[model samples]
Structure formats: structure tokens, C-alpha cells
Target: MFKKPIQKYTGKIGEVEIGTGEKAVKLGGESVLPFYSFDGNTGNTPKIGMEISDVYPEGWTNTLKELYKDVSNDTVKWAQFVEKKYSPDFICLRLVSADPNGKDSSPEDCAEKVKAVVEAIKTPLLVAGTGNHEKDAKLFEKIAQAAEGHNVLLMSAVEDNYKTVAAAGVLAYNNKVVAESSVDINLAKQINILINQLGIGNENVVDNVGCSAGGYGYEYVISTLDRVKLAALTQNDKTLQIPIISPVSSETWKSKESVEPEEEAPEWGNQEDRGISMEVAAAAGVLASGSNAIILRHPKSVEVMRSFISELLG
Candidate 1:
């Protein structure tokens, strides 16, 4: 009789639990390649988060606005609505208006939004900054202080700001940190190492090893994901074994393919459908590649990915 080869790993993706109690969402803890359950443990099933902004988003398409019209005006209301209606595993609040280059909002206001959203829902909450290294470090500090004891997941502690973010957010307030890096295995591993050097445990880290979901470089993302997963499982790379989470919606929606008007690209077909398709496709690609979780903007995209994940993991 012919039998299949069963390969197992010495290391497992460190599991991270967000929020608390029964409603908490767990990610990672896989002992084998994603979905290779026949060989070893798949750990916790991948999670999906619905992404909303701290303020009403300005450039969102009409399709998305219409779907979230009732609650999009208020950040807390938006999260509550999604949690109740769609039942996502978590909610991601992008501090869009906090950018000093843009709205120049204060960290205090942003933290208030975080407190409001966290209070409004039982599901876990994740917060992302405006990518300003200095501002984000301060913003994360305030958010950590305000949300202390609630234990939210801060979107990132990048190479430039890992020290500040890790210190204030993780050490001071007991929140988790997302160690983000560009889509390269070495960079990914390095960031994890740096964050770990600060005494942050594997269980407290999630990796955002970049995403090419918006445009043309999916192969890079796939390769990075594959290498990171292989190292974690086969080579027992502890730093690389952390779970991955990518923000797919913001990436896809900002791309020209999704933003172009029909009149400008008459041959491209309907605009909204194109955007949704792109979002779903990009998210599915990353999930298959090895993302432990993905946050999406559109409800339709979330609905589709939920079913896709269920079908695949089933």
C-alpha cells in the first residue's frame, strides 16, 4: 500500500490571544505548514477582522459607504455594528486622522477613539497608526495608557519605532505588538529578533511581513511567506514562527485598479465590482500563502473571505 509522507516540525507558531474570556480570538500555534493538517496540527483556525477608521473615511468608494452608511459616521458605532451584524473575529481601528502630515490630530483624541471602540464591542480590538515613526510611537503610548488592562493589539512596532512602541505599549500597559517589516524573510526575522531582544515574548508578537495585495508584486509576498513558514516549521526558527496578519482592504482599495472611474477606463467594467473582486482575491492569496489573519474593509469582501476560510479549513 502506498502511504503519504508525514512531515512535522520542531517549532510551532506562537499563539496570541486578543481580548479575554469567551469572546477572545486566538491566532497561530500551528505545528505544520498552514492547512497541512494531515501531517501535523493546524492549531487555531485563521481569524478575520473587519477594519474601520477612527474617523469617517474620506476616499472610500460609494459601494462601501452604502453598506456601512448607518454607523460609519462614528468609530465606536461602526465597530459595534460590524461585531453585531457580521460577527467578525475582531475589529481593526485605523487611526487615519492622526497623521501629522494630514489632519494632525492629537494622540489623546486617538486614544479616546480606541477606548470608545473597545467599550462598544465584546470582540477584540486592533489599532494601527499613521506610519509616522515619531508620532506613532507617542500615539501608541497614549493608546496603551488609556486602554491599559483592556489588552488591545497595537498594529505595529516597526524597525524604526520598535523600541518606543514595545516599551510603552507592551511593557507598560500589557498590550500586544505587531512587529512589521517589509516583505523579506531576513527583515522579517530581524524585526522579530529586535522586538524579542526587548523581552517581548513570542506569544505577544504578530508579524506584518508586508503585503502586495494592492498591486503587482504578489510573488514577492508569496515567497516571503513561504520562506518564513518553512523556517519556522522545518528549521525551528523561533522568531519567525509568530503568526502573520495583513491589512488587505486598505492596500487593495488604494490601488488604481480599484480607484479608477469607469469613464477613465471604459474597458475595465464596473468600478465597485472590480474593487470587491480585487479585495477578495488579494486577501485569499495571502491567506493561502500563510497569513494567520487578515483585516478587510468591505463587508462583501469579509462575507466572501469568511465563507472561503470556512470551506478551506473545513
Candidate 2:
């Protein structure tokens, strides 16, 4: 009985190599479905990214607030702490206070913060926003300029507002940019198309397939990531081949499965344990599905995931 050999696609964004080693982590180049070595090569294992914030998150689970409390209020300290303590390969910095209806920090304020963190660290940084479309447009523009030539990897330029952010990343900083769209494959393709049209080099872009916590909707995210890999290897679509990102830590915080205390949901175990489980499950699922990078919180979760990845690669 002869089974067909798995097909392999070598994906690239302009000149950027997809996956690990010379690239961030090997993710987009697989001939078969995930883990089906008989189908193709799973040359690169997943990589973990630590998530840090510019300001304190008002309602982060008490468990996390306490462990990271010492450095949580200061972005430079937090980033340095994670890099030194965890040895994370990448860092995700979220500019949350810049939300117009939130902390309302101005573009200049955001730029200063980014510059400070950039000055303090050497690992690649993923600059994300507070998810407010309009505010992020202005905020990322200034921040991108301040990070010019640092080769920073900007968190995102999504649909409806890719123009400004993509332009700044392409023209000013000459750095990498993440293009996020919903779980929809078409929308994901479109955003990647638009980014290239803006003259942003392909090698300088990654794609975020939208973060999903455990309990509900995780399947959709995982499936979409699988589709992107399929498109890259089978369809050989360049737009879909860019590295996929998972903001696993932030998305997990909002899930009821991770938040309800044991007294409230005794069968689920302690709230902290459930939360940590959710984080691990989410990381495992995303890693298996083909995400090259993950943004995570909680030192324990970071340790567990790193160990898991180490075992898988072994």
C-alpha cells in the first residue's frame, strides 16, 4: 500500500523566511497537516513570547498581579524582568493606556514609552495596542517612528486601518508589522494583500489569526491557523504563509473557565489552577495548529509551556 508523500511549501513574506532558526520559528512550511511527519516536514517547533504591558491592567487575575506586581507598573522593568528571569525569545508590549476612552495617553507619550523599552532591551519586541482602531492608528504611527531602525516587530495593522500603521512600519522604521484579521481566511488574505500593496516588504509582516481562549471559540482559531498553513503548503499562497501569532495570555484572562473561583465552580478546581490550565491548553492547541509565536503572561504558565515545547521538540 502506497500513501502519497506529503507536499511541502516554502513560504516567505517578500524576503522574510518563515519558521525558526534563521527565522523566528518554523511554522509555515509543512507538507502535511500538523504533526503528520509522514505527510511532510515539521522542521520548526513553536516559540513562546512573554507579554508585558505599558501600564497596570486594572482587573488582571489576582494571581498574576501578585507574581508580577514588583515590575508590573513599569514597562522597562517588566520587560527586563521577563527577559532576565524567563529567557523568553520574544516580548509583546501592549500600549493599553492609549485607548481614547481609557488612560488616553497621547501619541508622544506612547512613543516615549516604546523608546524607553527599546532602550532597555535587546530581544525583538511585538508592539500591540489597546484594540481601539482609531486611537491605535495614531498611537502606532508615533511609536513606530520612535522605534525606527531598531528593527522592532510592530504588533499589528489590521483591516479598516492598515494604511497608516503599515506605511509607518514600511517607510519610517523599516521594521516588521503584524497584520491581524478575524478567523476568516479571506479577510486574512486580504489584509496581507493590502499590506504588500502599501510597499511594506513581505518579510517584514506576520499575521495574527485573532486570539481565542479555551472553553469556547478556540476551535475556530485553531482551525483558521490550520487553514493558513494549508494554504501556504498546498495552495502555495504567500499572503497566508507569514508567521501566525497567538496572544494567548491576554485572551485567556477573560475566559470564565479561567476566572471563576473554586468556591464558585468547585468542580473546576482552584481558580488559579483552572486559569493556568486554560493558558496551557490554549498554548498547546495553538502550537499544534501552527502558530509560530505566542504572547503569554504568568511565569508558571511560561515555564510549563517552555517545558512542553522542549519535550515536543525532543
Candidate 3:
């Protein structure tokens, strides 16, 4: 009988700590590919973060609306609900109100909301700005200041708008920053390098490879993630070895297969199940591709993915 060969690598993913004292959560520090414990050490199991929005999720699907209906009107209450009910590893606060096209809320207001949520949650928090680059720079600066010393993860400093967020990470607080790049490994590396150049240590950086839902170029994201991980471990690429985070909920729920009702696509079967499955599939793909943390929505999806991670790590 032939024995399977075990592969070892020269580099390990850097570990990042969020929160402080007893509430802290440590992610990354894995020495091998996801779930490849037979080959090398899998230093930490992936962590799940539940998403909460600064503004009411008015445009969310009915299912999502129902899930948070009781607390939808209040961001602090919503964060508390997720922490108490689901016990997620962290709470991700999406500052949708800061969107330039949307409420365009003032930086001070957004910062106050961030501070309130930070004070309300015991688990670590991940704060994200609305997708407006120019506005996010100002938004994150205020948020980073409000969340100082709390050790939150402030996402993200992209290729074009890194200086502002990176400076906030260094000057405002010791929080980590997410470096996002379109689905290209080299671009991902470049952004990480640029973020580090701003004096943010590699350990304080997380990579986001521009996530895509299952049917919408998800495979491309997965392949890019795989290549990045390969570069980190196989070739010992320091610039590529930081932890990766996937905003699975945001990507999956936006897909037509997830949000479209069964009435629109009868062949898709139950709409609720379809949406949950879509999230689970996307999350599992990212986890297997070496993501250390995932931002998720839907309690059912969180439950299912938690079980899946347990099985993989076991």
C-alpha cells in the first residue's frame, strides 16, 4: 500500500488579536491550508461574525427583515440581539448610513453609533464603512477614533484609499485594517504592502480578495484566495501571509438566487432554503480557501456554518 505524502510549508499566517482582556478573539496563525491538519498545524479554527447595520435595513429581503424585525430600528439593540442569541465570535457593524448616496450621515453621528455598539458588545467588533471611498475615509477616521483602545477591526483600506484608513489605524487606535483588492493576487499583495508601508504592521492587516457570490464569479475569488495562500505558505511570501476575511453575508444575500422569491424562480425550490444554502456554500468555499474570519448574516446560516467548521476542524 502507498502512503499519502504530507506537505509542509515555510511560512505561517500571522495571528491577529481583536478586543482585549477576556473578550478578545484571536484569528489566523495557521501553518497549513484550511483543514489540512494531517500535513501541518491548523493553528486556529475560523471565526464567524454576525452583521449589523448602522441604518435600518430597509431594502433587505423580507426574510432578513423578519429575522431582525424586533431590533431593526436600533443598531445597538441589533448588536446585542446577535451577541445574546447567536453568540457569534464578533459583530460586524456596517455603516450603511454613511453612504454618500444614502443618508450621508455626518462623521460625528456615525462615530457615536460606532462607540455605542462597541460599548454594547462584549465580543470583538468589526466596523465597515459604506462603499463610498471618499466618504468612507472621513467616516472611518471618526469611527477609528471612537473605537480607540477597543481593538476593533476597521475595514478596509483599499488600493486607492488606503492612506486615510491606514493612518487612522496607526494614529487613532491599534485596531487592525482590512486591505481589499480586486480578484488579482498581485494586486492583493500590492495593497498589503502599501498598508504596511503606512506603518500598520502585517499582523494588524487582514486581506479581502473582493468576494463574489456563488454564481457570480465566486470561483474566481476562490482561485485568487488559493493562489494567495499558496504564495504565503509554499513560497513563504510575507506580504501575502496575513489573515483573510470574507464578507459572505453581503455577497451571498445580494445574489439573485438568494433574494429572488420562489414565485420568480419556481425551479429554485424554497426561497429561504436557497438563500441559506447559498450563504453556506459561499462561506464554506472561502473557509476552505484559507479565510480566517467570515462576516455572515442569517442565524440559520450561522448555525449551519458553525457545525461545518466544527466538523472540518475535528
Candidate 4:
């Protein structure tokens, strides 16, 4: 029997570094298709980030509700608990409460929470805005300043909002910027171009390949990410080559398979486990597809994902 020869990616576009003031991170080194254990090298493996919020989130599933319980209500304490107990490599802080109808925390208010959380942990941070473009810009502008020199990775700078947020991250924090686009390869590229045009170097930008849940367009999202990696490696497209970022928690949150009651979907098994498992599954899909950093919810889910990554790397 003839053993099949394995293909190795050339050079190392994924190996480029993202500057963080004095320090930098090597983005590439993946020799495999995401997490194909039986395939080439996934040198960096995957990183799991625990998600917290400056204000309590509404409409969370009972599974999350029960696990986090009271701690979910307090962002500062929540981050500390995750950092001290769970020991995740990163902590993702969502500024959801800054919404006008939500906690309505101003940019200043958001910055303080960021500062408090930053002081609470040594693990790197992923600070995300509430998704309201304008407010997110304002919130992250302050957040960038507060988190400056800490080398944190800012959650996002989308096509429409890239100018303000990207500028803030580059000028204020010297933090890494996540360039997000809906699940379109062209859009992903365009945003990357836009960020670079803003005088923010590629060394500071990460591609946020759009995300989806297990049952909701997962295949499409997966393929899109796959294209990104191929473009980066094969096409020599630098825009898609930067470390991929995905908010796996937010993406999986909407899946019925992740949030519906067990009784409503008995084939899924226990409700809590089903939710956590779906979150893990969605995350695994992205990891398999090609994501460098993922923001996740639930300590249990993060634990399982981290274990899976260990097995892949080991």
C-alpha cells in the first residue's frame, strides 16, 4: 500500500505578526485545515475566551441563566471569577448594557468596567461593543483608551464603523482590531482593506469571519471561513490571512438546537448539556474551518473546548 503524501502550505502567511506596542503575536502557523487532527499541523491550536458583559444580558437561555446565576449580573466580579477560577486564555467583555434601552452606560461608564476587568486578570482581553454601530464606536473609543498599552484585542471594526473604532484602537490602545463582516468573503476582504486604508497596519488587524450556529447556515459560514484560509495561504491574500476571530457565543446563542428546552427537542438529550454541546459544536466547526480566536459563553463549554484543543495540539 502506498502512503499518501501530505501537502504543506508554503512560506507562512499565517505566521505574520500583529503588533501590540512592544509585543506582537504570530498569526500564522496552521499547517492543517483548521483542526483536522489527522492532517497537517495546527501549530497554534485554538484559543478559548470566556465572555462576560458590562451589563446583564437579557433573553439568555435558562442553561446560561442557571450556571452563571447571580454572578452574571455583575461584570466586574464575573470576569474575576472566570479569570481566577476557570483560567481561560482570554476574557471577552461585551458592552451590551451600554445600549440606550439597556443599562445605558456611557462611554466613560464602559471604560471604568473595562479598567476594572483589565485589572482583575492577567489573561488577555477581547473587548466587544454592543453592536449598535454608533454607540459601539463611542463605547470602544473609550474602551480603547482605558485598555491602552494592555495589548488587549478589540472586538470589532466593521465596514460601516471601521473608521472610528479602528482609529481609536490604533491611536488610543495600540490594541489589535477585529475586522468583521457578515458571512461574505468579499465583504471580509473589503473590511480588511478599509482598516488598512485607515492607517491601521495589517499587523494589528484580525479577520472576523462571520459566524453561525450548528443548524443555522453552519455549512455556509464554514465554507466562507475555509475560503478565507485558502485565500490567505494559496492566493497570497494578506487580508484574510490574519488570525480569524469569531464570537462563538453570540453566533450559537440563536440556534434552537442550542437554546430550546430539552422537552421540545428530546433527541438532543438534556437541556443544559444540549445547549452547552451546541455551543461547543458551533465552536468546533469554526475551529475546524479556521478561526484563531473565539469568544465563548459558559464555563462548562469553555472547559470542553479547551480540552478538545489540547487533544488536537498534543
TM-score list, all predictions: 0.97, 0.90, 0.97, 0.89
The TM-score of predicted model 1 comes to 0.97
RMSD of each: 1.2, 3.1, 1.2, 2.8
The predicted structure with the larger lDDT, 2 or 3, is: 3
RMSD of 4: 2.8
The per-prediction tally of clashing pairs is 0, 7, 0, 2
The true-structure Cα RMSD of candidate 2 reads 3.1
- Using alpha carbons, what is the TM-score of model 2? 0.90
Once superposed on the true structure, which residue ranges of model 1 sit more than 4 Å away at CA? 214-216
Using TM-score as the measure, name the better of candidate 2 and candidate 3. Answer: 3
C-alpha lDDT values of all predictions: 0.88, 0.78, 0.88, 0.77
Candidate 2 residue 175 Cα shift, in angstroms, is 1.4
Give the C-alpha miss distance for residue 125 in model 3, angstroms. Answer: 0.5
Q: Write the per-residue lDDT of candidate 2 for residues 116-194, one digit (tens) a residue.
A: 9977887667788878888888888898899876677777788867999888876776767789898888999999999
1-314, model 3: which lDDT tens digit per residue? 99999997999999988887786888899989889988988987899999989878986788889999999899999999999999999999998888888888999999999899889889899998887888888888888899998988888888667899878875557788888889899999999888888777887888888888875588899999899999999999999989999999998888888888888899889988888888899999999998999998989999999999999888
Inter-residue clash pairs, candidate 1: none
The C-alpha local distance difference test score for the whole of candidate 1 amounts to 0.88
Residues 228-282, model 4: lDDT tens digits: 8887766677666677878889877767777778777788788777778778988
Alpha-carbon runs more than 4 Å astray in model 3? none
Candidate 2, residue 117: lDDT: 91
Predicted candidate 1 versus true structure: per-residue lDDT over 1-314, tens digit per residue: 98998885788888998887578989998898878878878889889998898777877987788888888888888888889888889889999999998898999999988988888788999999998888999899999988887779998899899999988888989989899999999999999999989988988989999887554477788888999999998899987989999888878888888989999998999999899899999989888878999989877898899889888777
